[model samples]
Target: MKNVLIVDDERSFLSSVSEGLSAYAAEFNTLTAENGKKAIEILNSTQVDLVVTDLKMPEMDGFELLAYMSRQFPDIPVIVMTAYGTPEIKERVQSMRVSQYLEKPLDFKELVDKIFLELAASSEGYIRGITLPTFLQLVEMERKTCTLKITSKGRIGYLYFNEGQLIGAETETDKGEKAAYEIVCWEDAEIEIESICRRKHRNISTTLGHIIMEGFRLKDEKERAVEKENIIEVGIEETGEVDGEEEIILETLEKEEKMNTLKDILNEFTKLQSVTAVCLVGRDGFLLDSIARTGIDTEMVGAIASSGFGAAESMGRQLGKGELTMSMLEFENGPVMFSPVGENAFLVIVAEKDANLGMIRLKLKKHSHELAAVAAI
Candidate 1:
């Protein structure tokens, strides 16, 4: 659940706001403060997720509190409020990391929406604003599972969390796991988790073995294209040519004809028994496309490979030398080979952990030039 701390200098304002929040049904643990001093003490002692404070106060102004929060606990979302929304105050509040600023005679709906957005974001292990859903999806793709337990009114509930979203409940309720799943998915359930225990017992979307078989099947299909002749060829293929765009087009046809057999040529490398997936991605890492056994996001895998290879390039540049020749990444159950085909492309092959690296490296070396030319297309 998102925790909200509201601070105002006016005693009546504090009481009314707190009482109003109480009167209205909501899913938040709301706290109130009449002064900044009490707010600070509470902030230091408690895990206050979001803060709403008045611009002008006795001890510390909203801006002062903003500055303090920014310096110390920058992750906490702050929203500055004031009756007089002068240009100066607006600009000042905006300058800080305040999530939202509100004028007097607050629009409760807007405030509620902003609060909901802020709290939703904060619940995803984010203090301040950061890209979400994408990160959350990435975690889901990884198939992570845990227990999210929250406490309220002295009663704590344990909800089962899968990947990054709450999937169900560890503790049986009146309705059971089905209700927990529905509640977490549809309702804005604040998993005010008092504790978390990561127990990876749940099944993932795809298994490693399944991914490998699909990769091998892709390689087999590529092999059938072998008997074709090079009716054309493309480029300044890999190396740049002095000729301009017109010639590049002519070269493209040539490349197409040559590569009519390119996939087949890649196939000649002998698809390993351990191959889970064989994907062809551009040098920049955009997946030209892929072949996977299971429901894996081939696009994401392509992106990850591209990103890793990009980082590798950066590492090479930092040394002022040493071009990235070949690279390999090993997981517990499998490994990925980053075989550079040319100046701007690579051949990625996923193999089982137990697969022979020597054979894979040899095949990559043999097909390095051919893969580069194909990728350039």
Candidate 2:
């Protein structure tokens, strides 16, 4: 028999759903929680096959609960219930990849059908008790040649390996290295291994270690972006009162002033000879802002720059250096420089090979204080 947990704040709705589902007691058991907190307690103590939850509750809302489940019990399927049912809400839930979504005033028979379907699907072809990263590492250690089929949240991807080296990966929308990055970052995936290697040529040139690290960085960046959007939405909702209008206007103006100051500092850097791009990046590897002469993925550059700078800082510490003020990486085409801007962020400068390094360094030192002042705001 399976156990299905239903979480909502309404006692009357819980009572009705539990009683209505009692007819199928022989097939499965129904569990109820008043809010996400209670649902978490029940989940910690009991074996739950599925979760059906509403989006809003007093303590520990549905979004928080879903995040907890994704980290702890990713293999278990979920069915989301929401009264708002707005496109924005649906899109957010879809991004989380829930098994099913049903609006409030749910049809009893339909809910039951979805529960059974999810339960049955969860039971099939799931390679439980192992993590994707661990399995990949083991395959590499064993020097195995094969292909892996991975499924998570209704998406499927394939990874091809030859003698333990990842050669290629494929998904519906991505291929090669990009696809591999996406697949490696997936959580709670069901994996199937086949003893065959179909792709003879290598499409992914980077080591598996690099791919995994980049995958995690990409995942963290995406999560942070989503969190920032949520915070902005909450801020807007909270400031909707007429009494807060003047305060809101003042705050907006202050923000604009700080932004203009930062942009001015960036513009100074852009005016330097042979300078291709200038970016302000958070210490956590997120791009705060940028100015560039050409099209470039500044976010990716920010993340990589942070990682590289971190390594350089570690090296300096080991070498008994007092502190790391600046670091630079030079390639055949250009040089990239990284320097601390403020306590919370850093500055990056990309310049052509023929650029005057002495003048660039001098300008960087001159404007670093100004940039730091604006960044601190």
Candidate 3:
């Protein structure tokens, strides 16, 4: 069963909508809030799948509620209702990414249909097949307020968020930023979202971006240590002898070869005209590797590129077009390109707006297979 939160200031209208939706009681339960403040209280305690809100209210209006939801409950879809609907108002509502907007005197059947559609499209209360870094970037981007219970390798940890900022984190034996770093670096972590944040006081002062970068560094170090240990153990087991010096040399050569292969491929894009950044990103939005001349957030770039490319591919399918070969988004400063590298990852190129796009496309096509080969490795 699903819960639908309806927020409206007018008592009579609210009652009418609730009564009308009661017919679908078996399908979903309706929760009513007179204003946004009350609505938030319900959200903190209940698992709401959809929100239907009126734009005007005394304490907190629909827009305020929508802003709050965008930060805290972005996965939940919303339907905006307003009596004073205009073109301008519709445009503003669209920008907020509302699932549907119905002017005053809405059709009851239409409203119910929209609700059902939105609910059906939701994530079934589980966020899966997404990387932790990508999910964290989403929380930061949306300014969400929630607590995430993360389980990885049979160990559990908690990350608290208040309005999109990572306020606190903890494991059974650790707390604060140190715990956060460890949790972020965990492999194959599963996340469960809680709408309420229990931590009122901030415990971590480090920025999320810096924390993520540091976490990746720590993860790399830990992986290297494990690899070295495994190599030593294998030698001792197979030959009944351990040569620390030889193992160290072999590890160094292996690491160098792997790094050089990907590095050489990424470096080629840096030599191109007006290129600012080049990256290989996993389909799940993880940044595999990157080369950048500018101070761009490569992680953020990779996350956005993966999401945008997915949307483009979806759009193509809907339009009866073929597979997405390449897609680009042109902004005032530059253009960002996305193309599939292999089944598991893609390539991203960020360049100045006036850069020779034709040449860049040619280079991208020429090198895509090579990058795919490296990714396969």
Model 3 spans > 4 angstroms off? 1-128, 235-377
Q: Which regions of candidate 2 fall more than 4 Å away from where they truly are?
A: 1-128, 241-377
Candidate 1 lDDT over residue span 123-177, tens digit each:
8765562111111222223233445443323444454445444444443353333
Of candidate 2, the 10-residue stretch with the lowest lDDT total is 89-98
TM-score of 2: 0.36
Q: Which prediction has the highest TM-score against the true structure?
A: 3
Model 3, range 1-377, lDDT digits (tens) per residue? 89999998888888999999999999999999999899999999999888888766778766456556645665667776755346643443332222455667888988998788668767554321234654565455446677888887799999889988999999999999889989887766666766678799888999776677677556655776687678656656766545665666567656665667578668867765467999999988989899997679999988888889899989999999988899888999989889998888899999885454654665566567657876776
Q: What is the C-alpha local distance difference test score of each model?
A: 0.57, 0.76, 0.75
Query: What ordering of candidates by TM-score runs from best to worst?
Result: 3, 2, 1
Better of 1 and 2 by lDDT: 2
Best candidate per lDDT, number?
Answer: 2
Please give the distance, in angstroms, between residue 188's alpha carbon in candidate 3 and its true position after superposition. Answer: 4.6
How would you encode candidate 2's per-residue C-alpha lDDT over 246-363 as one tens digit per residue?
4675577557656876896798678654689999988888888999876878988899998988888889999999678999899999999999887878899999875546546655
Clashing pairs in 3: 71-144
